[model samples]
Target: MYIPLFDIDGTLLKGGGGNQAHKNGGSYAFRTVYGLDDKACWDNIITDGKIDKQIILEVVEKNGISHKKALAKLDEAIDATTSYYLEHSNEGTCIAADGAIELLEELQKQNVPLGLLTGNIEAIGIDKLSKAGLAKYFEFGAFGNLALRRVDLIEIARERAIKLVGLQMTTSKFMIIGDSTLDVKCAKDGNIPVIGVSTAKSSSQELAEAGADLVVESLLQKDDIVKFILD
Candidate 1:
């Protein structure tokens, strides 16, 4: 059976302004942990496809904090950011992408294993999925806190999937479903097939150009998506 590892933010969930909550949490962490009060410092950094620690380090370094200092405070900052997001973002703030749940249901019905490979910290990712009612669909996840680069999560996810399913699945037996070129890049780096869904920031053209094996406008293309995965 094939295992599809989905990206959380854009692939499974969208809108609800929960992202603002994450930004607010990051700013809060900066002020509380690093003593940096510049919200713009946190806001200006591009966070796409990067892990939480990478984002935090970038923000702190941009504000003149040394790399060592940022590393020392990284865990605390991540905790603060997660705490703030969990406290602020509730079910109302997480909206499942169009046809996301249906797609999961169809895949699940086919006995395909579902997992998460996302740049979100574990807690925040779970919170968002729980809010969107997507948490139940995923059996395991490789979260952002586990690595500094998105590509690294691919191997971790594979190992975990092997353990969870008790099967020695090769990279070819796995597929990545996400909405960003970063996701495509991660898959390419790990030698995994990737399907790009243009339901968020990155467009289909960009994802195709990034070398995604398949690109779809959205998960709403359920038949095409399912066929790609099973094939």
Candidate 2:
């Protein structure tokens, strides 16, 4: 059976106050851990398509903290970030992207094993998905806290999927569906097929250039997407 691993932020959910909630959470963490008061600290950082830990390290390092000390405080910062996001994220603002729920439902109906592969830490990702009514579709996932790179996360997810199915599935049996160039590159690097959804940052052309096997304008093209997966 083929397994599809979906990206959460832009690919599944959209236009939620989730982004603000994350920034607020990150700011709170920085304040609590590093004494940084600037709430807009992440304003200049390129956060899209990157994992939470990588973002944290970049912010702390740029603020003059040594790598060793930052690593030591990593768990502390992550906890603070997760706590704040959980407290502040508004469920009402969490909107499912166009056709996201429908496509997921169809895939579920077809008995396609679904999983999440995202840069979001587990807590925040689950919170957002729950808010968007998407958590039920995924039983397990490979989250950002597990790795700094998306490619590594793919490997981790593949291992977990194998354990879940109790089968040694080849990497080709896995597919990544996401909206960023990083998603395409990571899937390419791992030698897994990737479907790029142009629902967030990257355009279809950019995703294709990044080596995506398929580039979709949105999940609205459910028939085509479903056929691709089944084939």
TM-score of each: 0.94, 0.94
For model 1, residues 1-231, the per-residue Cα lDDT tens digits are: 458999988889885457778878888999999999755675567887777888889989989999999999899999999999888885247889999999999999998889899988899889889878899998888998888778888888888887886657777788799998889998899888899999886999999999998899989999998998888
- lDDT (Cα, tens digit) per residue for candidate 2, span 55-84: 999998888789999989999999999999
For all candidates in order, the CA lDDT equals: 0.86, 0.86
Candidate 2's C-alpha runs over 4 A off are 164-167
Residue 181 alpha-carbon offset, candidate 2, angstroms: 0.6
